[model samples]
Target: MKTPNMITKSLLLSAALATSAVLCANAQIKLNSKTVGAATKAVKAVTLSNEDVIEYTKEYIQWMDEHNPVAPADDEFAIRLKNLTANLQNYDGLNLNYKVYLVKDVNAFACADGSVRVCAGLMQAMSDNEVLGVIGHEIGHVKNTDSRDAFKSALMTSALKDGVSSQGGTAAALSDSQLGELGEQVANMSFSRKQESIADDYGYKFLKDNNINPWYMSMAFQRLLDLSGGASEGGFTKKLMSSHPDTQKRVDEMAKKATKDGFEKPTS
Candidate 1:
């Protein structure tokens, strides 16, 4: 009894529903494989001293400031982030610095030297508390020395790129140019699943320490899950989950932590 146009709409709706069902199924089973990331080639471990880490991190921060276009210090997002992170600065001899980049990518990161960079797109996508949760996770990385491992991984990878080998765990000092190249690599380095889990624990603890709603951790992950289209099927599957494992598991863990801390579940 339906007209031709009405029948066409019905078919489209049915097709969409079918696609959603398939995506849901795929999401459940997609992360079962142990190896998830695209980069698989192993790099031998290289050791860098704490002095080396500090110097290299400083240079890397300088290079980023010089090369990348950052949001103006007075810009709304920059100011907002500065204010939000104010309380986290100057604690335990760890002086944290915060900056906002005008990049379109929805990302935020922290370095071993306590430099935090937040992208404008990420701020636009996440709420204030969610942003705080992400910042806390990054701070956790620095606190747990995960950033040190990431830097070492990057240096090792760069050594391969430069055709250099280490001797007895004491490698040649990277040249300024090589260090710059290594810096770039370190900037993009992804932490292991264990490191991320530790960072998540730190984030939850940070929320509690600052009298913030611990549920923000769950809210942040849920926001990411939603932004990734509620399934591990597209860009989210390829990028975010590729580096970080088990998005849904992370969300569930955060929810459990929040509930354990006597916080209500985040609805959104």
Candidate 2:
């Protein structure tokens, strides 16, 4: 009973039990912890809350609909956009509520909480896959919390109130058009080219991860590049105004990454 073999076995069993207990402890840590909760939630908390973004965007769009000629598409567009975004985003642990405005501008943006707003003009300009690429780029912005950072920077640099509503900061008591100026000011916000690269990296990661054709994003950017020299068609102003890199070069880089990452096209 006192043999060395018996003692060795006992020690081995004890060590194995200890290791198992340690692992279980590690694995059982709360999924709701700061690092492990919903990925989108982290984006919101660190950058901007989705709820606030949605509320503000909704109110802003509603006002725009009333004051301007633009209106959001019928529910059908929302349904289609949401479906398309969900399919692509499922791979990244993110989702979105896509909205299309009947504006003539070629711009699209995503707010925190996956609120994606696209101009009808932008929608009409690209193929479905190309549009997915465009949306993926904006999703990169949302994931990177650019909207929050950009909005904050805009607010800091301006003397204007937060919005039309009496929400944040001192009131300038400006009229609706003046408030619109503030909105444009906020929207015109841009980050360094570094930020644009980061957004591109995120976009690439998303495309590669999701098994969507990674080249689509690149191709979409190429389209932007091709359109860059023209009269802008006015509707293309927003896309042109974005502080992104030369679309053609970005497209080439994305293609290279897609190849390096071994991205396989989704069958179907």
Q: Pick the candidate with the highest lDDT.
A: 1
Point out the worst 10-residue segment of candidate 1 by lDDT: 11-20
Pairs in steric clash, model 2: 106-235
Flag regions of model 2 displaced more than 4 Å.
1-82, 86-95, 161-178, 230-245, 263-268
Candidate 1 regions with alpha-carbon error over 4 angstroms:
1-47, 160-180, 231-240, 243-245, 266-268
Query: What are the per-residue Cα lDDT tens digits for candidate 2 across 1-268?
Result: 0111111100000000000000111122212222323443333333433444334434333333343333444465556566666665443555555556665555566554444556566676776676777666666665666655554333334443222222232221333443344355544355456656776777666665666677777767666666656232322333332454345566678777777777643332
| Residue pairs in candidate 1 whose N, alpha carbon or C atoms collide under 3 angstroms | none
Alpha carbon lDDT at 173, candidate 1? 33
Per-model lDDT: 0.57, 0.46
List model 1 lDDT by residue over 3-77, tens digit each: 111111000000000000001111121111222222321222234465555554564455455445577878999
- Highest TM-score, which number? 1
